[model samples]
Target chain A: EPEVTQTPSHQVTQMGQEVILRCVPISNHLYFYWYRQILGQKVEFLVSFYNNEISEKSEIFDDQFSVERPDGSNFTLKIRSTKLEDSAMYFCASSLRAGEGDTQYFGPGTRLTVL
Target chain B: GQQVMQIPQYQHVQEGEDFTTYCNSSTTLSNIQWYKQRPGGHPVFLIQLVKSGEVKKQKRLTFQFGEAKKNSSLHITATQTTDVGTYFCAAHAGKSTFGDGTTLTVKP
Candidate 1:
């Protein structure tokens, strides 16, 4: 089965450095999303994208975060400057349909570590 | 107070024993999805329940949607070591929100 894949499975960056997390969703999928999980915490939604634009975002997705579908298959999340609290497992997910019942497939996740 | 809450955050069952997790949401849901994430792994979709009081079974696992469409449960019969993981119940509307998850540990 086709699955969402993310690059740089593990990323380490300085506290004030910018970082980009990349994802290649299933070729035919239309909607994409970014979620993060602090160690020992529930996964929190960051943002959702469709038609190369953001559909919704949570408070955690503040000024520092931005998402783009720079190419047909590549969806990237950029954080302008990392903080200690930014260290978490960032996951990329996608679904064929942009509806409530559609199943969203998640990537293995990129573990971001801020130093 | 819209949220999905799961009970008994952790469960430990001996091999061949049964296990079940409950999920309740404050608001009605268009659908409910169950996912399993093994330790140090990503969430894998298990199944989705859309209709009120709907029940679906996958192998030894069974999922049920509540009559009010605000609750759900996942039951595993004769658990195996492979069943050890954190099971999350994600409620769906225009946006999807997941419960804190129930961690299951199966002992051999």
Candidate 2:
């Protein structure tokens, strides 16, 4: 089955450095989302994108965070400057529809480690 | 944003024993989804329940959506060592919110 794919399974960056997490969602999916999980914490939503724009975002998705569909298949989350708290497993998900009724497929996730 | 909660933060069971996890949402959910993440791995979608009071099963697993559509449960029959992992119930409103998750440890 077609699945979401992310690049750089793991990343290590210095505090205050910039990092970009990339994802390739399923071809036919229309809604894309970004979520992250701190070690030993619940997965938290970051943002949602549709029609090439952000539909909603969580408080954690502050000014430091940005997302883009630079190309047809590439969905990316950029952190302007990493903080120690930024270290977490970032996941990308996509679904064919916009409702909870639709199943969202997730990528394996990119483990971000900021020191 | 919505809030989803899961019960029994952790569970320990012997092989051949049964396991169950509960999921509740503070707000009415349009739908609920279950996912399993093995230790050191990522979350994988297991099932989705939409209709009120709907029930679905997969092999040794059974899932139910509450009649009020505010809660759900996942039941596993005859657990195995391979069943050890964290199970999460994610409810999607406009945005998706995942519960803390129930970690299941099946001792062999």
* Best candidate, DockQ: 2
Global lDDT of each model?
A: 0.92, 0.93
Model 1 steric clash pairs: none
TM-score of 2: 0.97
The TM-score of candidate 1 is 0.98
The C-alpha stretches of model 1 lying farther than 4 A from their native spots are none
Error of 2 at A84 (Å): 0.4
User: What tens-digit string does per-residue lDDT give for candidate 2 at A1-115?
Assistant: 9999998899999999999999999999999999999998888999999999999899999999999999999999999999999999999999999946788888999999999
Q: Give the CAPRI rating of model 1.
A: medium
Interface Cα root-mean-square deviation for all models: 1.3, 1.1
- CAPRI quality of model 2: high
Mark the 10 consecutive residues where model 1 chain A has the least summed lDDT. A39-48
Predicted complexes: DockQ each: 0.73, 0.81
- lDDT (Cα, tens digit) per residue for candidate 1, span B1-108: 469999879999999999999999999988999999999999999999999999999999999999999999999999999999999999656566889999999899
